[model samples]
Target: MLESLLWGAVAAAPLVLGAVLAGIRAWPDRLLGIVLGFGAGALIASIAFELWQDGLEQGGPVPLAIGVALGAAVYFTADRLVERWAKRAGGGAAAGVPLALGALLDGIPEQLVLGFGLADGAGVSVALVVAIFVSNLPESIGSSSDLLDGGVKRPAVLGIWSAVAALCALSTVAGWALADVASASIRTGLNGFAAGALLVMMVDSMIPEAQKRAKDLAGVATVFGFALAAGLSALGG
Candidate 1:
């Protein structure tokens, strides 16, 4: 448990870095997109090649199907609700609350997957945590900045981010605990579902953000991120 929590902290490091970066200078929207895209691509690839594959090898088709469906449903539903709330809030001070809430919720599954991976094995968990930490940094910073730009106080912004971070950590703990007692088939299903959900998130959030930054840069970053993740996966394996 201690090791898993430590790994979770490591996984969240990128998010903390990104939040700090957001305070540095005005990042071009397109550049942001590119960076996020690369990160997302890496995440998707890692999920597919590492986690999902292992799950399938462990349990077979039923687990994969159940996991995929559950993950997709959870991601899509949560996203839709958040989008609606954000849209209703519009571009005002009040918008910050919903935006922060949405971003926090969006991070839950990622944390859950991180914990699940760790519970499975140290090598796999470490690789996934590192990759995810790298990916999450920009997002945390960007989201915090967005809230600040929308007129949220700095203290409030930090508080909300901290809370969200705590929630993410909690999710990982929960996932680790649940996975410990779960059947092999259930574990496989959960991992598969997580991969599916992560893929959707990458498409919906990370890729769009990266593309909005700089198309060429985003493309390069995406490739580089995937390569880096692949290397990490190999090392871990």
Candidate 2:
């Protein structure tokens, strides 16, 4: 459990770091959007190389399919509620919503995969660890920056992202505990759930926002991010 917690913290470390960096200076919206796109790209690699492949191996087709559908449904419903709340709150509250969603959606499963690997005695990959760092950094950075821009207090923004990072880190321990008892299908289902939620966030939140802000450069930034993170995954293999 201690090991799991430690490793989980390791994976989530970038979130806090990113938030801290976000406070160092006021960043331009266009640059922040490009960074978000870059993080989304890294997340894409994580979904493909880590979540989907592991899920396919563990649960086969049926459970993965069911998990994906369920995950999508849950996220969509939650997102609607979030949007309504954001509208009610007024101001730029909605701007940071998707980024927060992305962090929540993928953070759990991302660390859980690590926890499961630890439990299974699978050797941790240094490159994959770096890949997680790559994926998480810009996410928190963009989210923090967005919140600051949206009229959110800096202290509150710090608190919010910090809480998220803590939860994600704890999820590693949850996965570690679950691994001993969870069947292969269950593991796959969880992975599928993460993948499904992440994909949706990418489409509705990350990609569109990046495109809206960064315009033509969003695609280039995304591809650059993909190549970098994917290259890291390749090194792991």
Candidate 3:
């Protein structure tokens, strides 16, 4: 469990790093969009190669499907409610909350999946870690920058991202502990759930946000991210 928590923090470290970079200076919207695009691509690759594929290998279609449906429903409903709450609690830059919150929601399951992967004594999945770290960097950077632009205090932005990162690390520990005693089908379902959540997040937040800024360049950046992650996975194998 300790190992899982440590590794989870290692993977989520990029969020804090990204937030720090945002604190250092304001980022141009176009550049931020490009970064978001790349992250989206990397995240998609993770869902395909790391999460979904592995879930199928572990428990087959039925469990995977059920997990995916549940995940999507949970994320969609929760995200909408959070958005409403943030709107009601409007402050200087509360707009940033939705984005950061989305990242948090996305990260928890992902880190949990990481913990699950480690539970089997198979060692860590280098590909998944790389994908997550790469993907999370842009998310924090973009969201933190947005908060700053919206007149949010720097410390608050950093604090939010840091807290979310910590939560994700704890989630990894939870996954590891649960997986230790879970049936094979349950493990597969969990992976599927993570994958489903990831897919929804990309569509709901990352991709649209990216395209909102860089437009044409966003597509290219996405391809670059995907190719890079895929290449890394191949090499790791």
Candidate 4:
């Protein structure tokens, strides 16, 4: 139980930090390009060094390819649907629903994959947790900023973020439980799929937004942010 809670905290750390960072000044738009560049690099590295290799070792090329293709397709379709919905709703509750539901849906699968990795071995789990944490930090910050920009009160923003963190905890715990019953091949495939999905998400969404906000000190801050993430990944490794 203590171990699970500790892992949960590790998972939530990035989101908490991101929320705090979002309260800072907006970054410049140009910096978004740079951040996206680094993010793309990181995603590639994660896929090559961790997800792809691990999946191959555990399942083989066929399963890894299938998982990657499926994951990519799902996210691509979901992204299109969400964009359409957001366009139709145009800032009303309907607009918010897609974003909130997307975020909520994201948490479950991601945490579940991480939990399975962690259950397999400390090294695999730690590497993935670190990667996800690094990725989530920027995402959380962006989410908070979007909410605030959309006129959400600070208290409400904090509450929503906190609730999401709690959901992450639940997802991680549930994943750990599932790890006990699931086959290693299935777990590996799922993790690979998650890696692919995250790559698409970072490329198409997070990095683009971060780049849009990059300018002046924001550019420098974005570089610092990537450095921090890289450092954390190294330390965790």
Candidate 5:
């Protein structure tokens, strides 16, 4: 538990740090786009080589499929609802609620997988940790900045980001606790759930933003991120 907590903090620390950093400095959208593109690529490799492979091996197809479907549905519905609320409120997600949901949607599962991976006593995966950290920083920075621009006070923005970070960190402990009592099938299904959620997040949020901001550089950055993370995944394995 302690180990999972420590690792969880290490992975999630970026949210708080990024929020603080964004508050202090203004980032260009193009740079944020490139970073997000890089992160998307890293997460893509993670879903493919790590999450999906583990799910197929541990639980077979049925639970994995159901988990994936449920995960997609959950994230899609929640994201849409948030978007609707933003529309009603005045502007896009950035102006209304900020993009913290974007971070949380993926953050929870990554932390869960982190704890689950540790359950086998083989230690955590550096690949997953790096992917999470890289992805999280830009999202938090964008979210925090947008919130500030929307007239949300600085302290409130930090508090909101802090809350998200805390919840995401605690999910690691929850993952460890759940994994301890879960069957192989259950673990696999949960892994599939994480992968599905991540896929939606990339498609709906990360990639589009990257394209909008980074333009030609987006594809290149994504490819670079993929190659680096894939190599790390091999080494971690």
Candidate 6:
């Protein structure tokens, strides 16, 4: 459990770093878009290679299908509700809340996967960890800045991200606890669930945001990010 917590924190620490960066300096939208593009690509690759593939192998097709469907439905529904609430709040001041919710949606599943991976006693999923770290840094930077732009007090912005980081870190422990007693099918379902959630998140939030901000260059960054993560996975395997 302690190990899981340690690794989880290590993976999520970038959010704090991103918040500090946003607090300290101004980042151009183009740059944030490019970073998000890369992160989206990397996360997509993680879904394919890290989460889904392993899940399919461990639990076979049925659970994978079920988990994926449920994960997508839940995330999509919850995201819409959050967006509606944000809109109801009125003005750009509420924009950051949605972004923060999005991050939580994305982060929790990824972190859960991290704990699950560690639970096997097979060591950390270095590829997944690297991808998570890479993806998170840009996300945090963008979200933190959005919060600032939304007129959230700076300290409050930091506090929000800090709390998120702590929650994600603890989610790993939850995964670890489950791993200790779960059947193979359950483990596989969890992986598939994480994959589905991540895919929906990328399509619904990350990719659109990247395109809105980076324009054409976002494509290039995405390709590079995918290639980089894929290479890392191949090498690790």
RMSD of each: 3.4, 1.3, 2.0, 4.2, 2.2, 2.0
- Superposed Cα deviation of residue 53, candidate 6 (Å): 0.8
| Candidate 2 runs further than 4 Å off | none
Candidate 3 C-alpha lDDT tens digits along 1-237? 789988989988988999899999878889999999998888777777767887888889899899888778877887788677667777545655655766776678777777777886768767656766777898888888878887889899889999999998898888888876877688777777777777787788779989998999999999999888877766555
**Residue ranges of candidate 1 with Cα displaced over 4 Å:** 91-128
Q: Which of the numbered candidates is closest to the native, going by highest TM-score?
A: 2
For each predicted model, how many residue pairs clash, with residues at least 3 apart or on different chains?
18, 0, 0, 11, 0, 0
User: Cα lDDT of all candidates, in order?
Assistant: 0.66, 0.84, 0.80, 0.61, 0.77, 0.78
TM-score of each: 0.79, 0.95, 0.90, 0.73, 0.89, 0.90
TM-score, candidate 2, is 0.95
Native-to-model Cα distance after best TM-score fit, residue 173 in candidate 5, in Å: 1.3
Candidate 3: regions farther than 4 A off: 90-92, 125-127
lDDT (Cα, tens digit) per residue for candidate 6, span 177-223: 87767776876777777677768877777788889999999999999
Model 4: per-residue lDDT, tens digit, 1-237?
445556766877676666666666664445434544444444455556656766788788777777777777777788788778767767632222223333444555566766775676654445556676655655566566676666666677667777877887777777777888877677666756766676667656655565565534444555565565556556555
Winner by TM-score between candidate 5 and candidate 1: 5
Write model 2 residue lDDT over 1-237, tens digit each, in one string.
899998899888888888889988998878988998898899899888778877888779888888788777777888888889888988487667677777887788767777888888887778987998888898888878888888888888888888888999999999898888888887888888888888888888888888888888999999989999989988997
> Which stretch of 10 consecutive residues in model 3 shows the poorest summed lDDT?
90-99
lDDT of 5 by residue, 57-128 (tens): 888988888878877888888888877887787763345142477567667876776777777676766665
Q: Pick the candidate with the highest lDDT.
A: 2
Model 4: residues >4 Å from true position, as ranges? Answer: 24-40, 91-107, 117-131, 215-237
At residue 163, what lDDT does model 4 achieve? 82
Ranking by lDDT: 2, 3, 6, 5, 1, 4
Candidate number with the higher TM-score (2 or 3): 2
